[model samples]
Target: MPSSTSTSVSSFSHHFYTLLLLSVLLVAFFPGAFHYLSSLPFAYLSAASSPSSTHQPSSDQGPTTTATNTMSWFQKQFSLPPRSRGSYLVTDHVASAVPEIAQYKVGLLNLFVQHTSCALSLNENWDDDVRADMSDALDRIAPEAGPKGQELYRHSAEGADDMPAHIKSALIGASITIPIKDGKLATGTWQGIWYLEFRQVKHTRKVVATIQGEKA
Candidate 1:
């Protein structure tokens, strides 16, 4: 027969370990329940940073729901009509083209222009003068092929403006990435997307939009 004192001591030990395990599990699953849980253990903190903490499956097994998946891929394409030489606001165009952009609660939208003579940028969308001014500035940097600034390069095989267009394109870039949040683009209120055309003749432009992240 066990002594009462031994039984009491065994019960105490069991309760102590049970409470400790409960504490760890509580902090691991519902961290917000206990404010002081951060002081508990290293194991709990490590679990918080684990990959599974946030990443959710992107399967279509159920209706699309908002989630911050560690990895997923959603894509879209935009074909804009003729835009004259200059920087133009395409925020609405983009939104229309990618209507499903709002499905993502948190993610990233990457814009890539297929043409080599154009660029994509994020800038002030309100003022038209800003676009014109930016166009003037870029043109000054890589002016069109002319006697005053540039002599159409040999590569002007495309056109007198083609060489400078390539220079301007390099100066800017062909792609941009913007974050997504709350089913909308996470850009500042004053920020807007722009399509910069560096060519003389207007033509249909194609932009590929690649979205990846948590779907809402």
Candidate 2:
């Protein structure tokens, strides 16, 4: 029979080997466990690592952390239905096509008109006369060629009104930016978007709508 001292020594050695094997297995299977546990919230690993720690936050003062998504970016392209050679109020129309913009709590919504003969702008929303006035003003600035016997432009490959259309597009601009808030456009009470159609004939237009911001 083994002596008491020898038996106790053997038992101690077996326990030590068992513990060492367990530790090795843990490290082998979970190489990053230490880092992951360390990075966890204090309360997560504190109970086992620090039983007497008084730095624990109370129930009421529990982690005030909130889950938030990382800064995001999204873009989409949509077509603007064909319209005649006149400035038209299309604020709601564009927004309707891009429901994703309404999902954003705050961000900048951008509209880029791809056609050179058509452009985008911001102007009065109410009163139809504002659109008429803008159309008349642009006409005066870059009137369609003909009738008056004025062939002032050289690029007539498209048509008599084509060159003036390009000029008008340049004047109005090809894109516009609007602030989005509360899942809707933050346009002024009287502000609206305008798609300036410089071409005499109607043609389908494509508008690239890009929105970036936090979701509500």
Candidate 3:
């Protein structure tokens, strides 16, 4: 009986030492792999519990976010009466033309001029001298005639001021973007939209306005 017990104890000790050595080798050579294997059970538990434990809907309000917050767009085209070559304030004209703008709460207004010889800009609205001064400055930059009263450009198919008008139109932009809030333009107190006409003769211009925002 004593000899049988001693043999069984020796076999068990040999198996225990083999398993311990294998575990130590794995820990020393593949630490990351061991860690990932150890975390698999926890990850499985989390995934299994998430569906029932985390995403419980409330009794009152369901998913109402996308339905309530929707966006809309509006567009309009209007014409400006023929006027002499100069800078003219046209804020009120735009507002009157696009009455649909009042239906928006927060949005953007983009005013684009269809003609190439004319431009749109924002500048001082309260003073008339500013307009005259701006026109004078632009004229000096791109004059129609030289000092000897001679034409300076080659493209004069329209008139003496045709090339100069094109230059001015390129310098100043043909489009202006303004913020719309509470159904009105959010320009500063002294700021207004300017339609710069560079032609020598009075010409009618077309403007297209677009609005994008949420309704009030």
Candidate 4:
């Protein structure tokens, strides 16, 4: 009996020494093992204390109810339309339009013009001279009725301004995207949105402005 007990003790000692040597070898091979093992106790404690696991919903309760509850907290959506002709400052109009489309603060402001002849751009709106200078510059670059104008463009079924307008639209572009923050369009202090009307005749112009952001 004494011999058997000694054998059992020697076997346990050998196994313990082998396990210790293996652990040391693993730690030496992988330095991060110690950090990972050290964190296990804290992770176990955190899992034990987490409220979500403690308050799990019953299986009979449908997930749809929770989803519905979450969806009900969302803010309402909104949309606004504004039209302009000739030259106009649309900053105030944009500011006023946001209240109708979305109750939350604006994240992104997208201004798009439907007509190819008309377009949107950002420039100084404080002085009339700025606008006049822009108009004059455009005229200098692409005149309304001239030799270059007549030779380069032939699709003038809509009269002289038609082709010129198309040229100007191509030079400038038809859409502008602006950022919105705190219920206002976030443009530079000197910058303002401009609606460039290329046609000589009076025509109603439509501008579609969209605001996207999370609700307050």
lDDT of 1: 0.86
TM-score of each: 0.66, 0.68, 0.71, 0.58
| Sliding window of 10 residues with minimal summed lDDT for model 2 | 64-73
Error of 3 at 30 (Å): 42
Which tens-of-lDDT digit does each residue in 146-198 have in candidate 1? 65655856787777788889998998899999998877888898899999998
- What does candidate 3's lDDT look like per residue over 98-186, in tens digits? 99889999999999999999999999999999999999999999998999998799999988899999999999999999999998899
Q: Which stretches in model 4 have alpha-carbon errors above 4 Å?
A: 1-86, 147-151
The per-prediction CA RMSD against the true structure, in angstroms, equals 13.2, 7.7, 8.8, 10.7
Most accurate candidate by lDDT = 3
Error of 2 at 200 (Å): 1.1
Q: What is the Cα-based lDDT of residue 167 in candidate 3?
A: 97
Q: How far is candidate 2 from the true structure (C-alpha RMSD, Å)?
A: 7.7
Q: Using alpha carbons, what is the TM-score of model 1?
A: 0.66
Worst 10 residues of 3 by lDDT: 61-70
Which segments of model 3 are wrong by more than 4 Å?
1-67
Global lDDT of each model? 0.86, 0.85, 0.92, 0.68
Instruction: Write the candidate numbers in order of decreasing TM-score.
Output: 3, 2, 1, 4
* Clashes by residue pair, model 2: none
lDDT of 2 by residue, 1-216 (tens): 889999999999999999999878887999898667667877676667865634656799868444657655778888887888888898879888999987888999989988898899999889999889888998888876556777879888998888888898888899999999989999999999988888878899998888888888
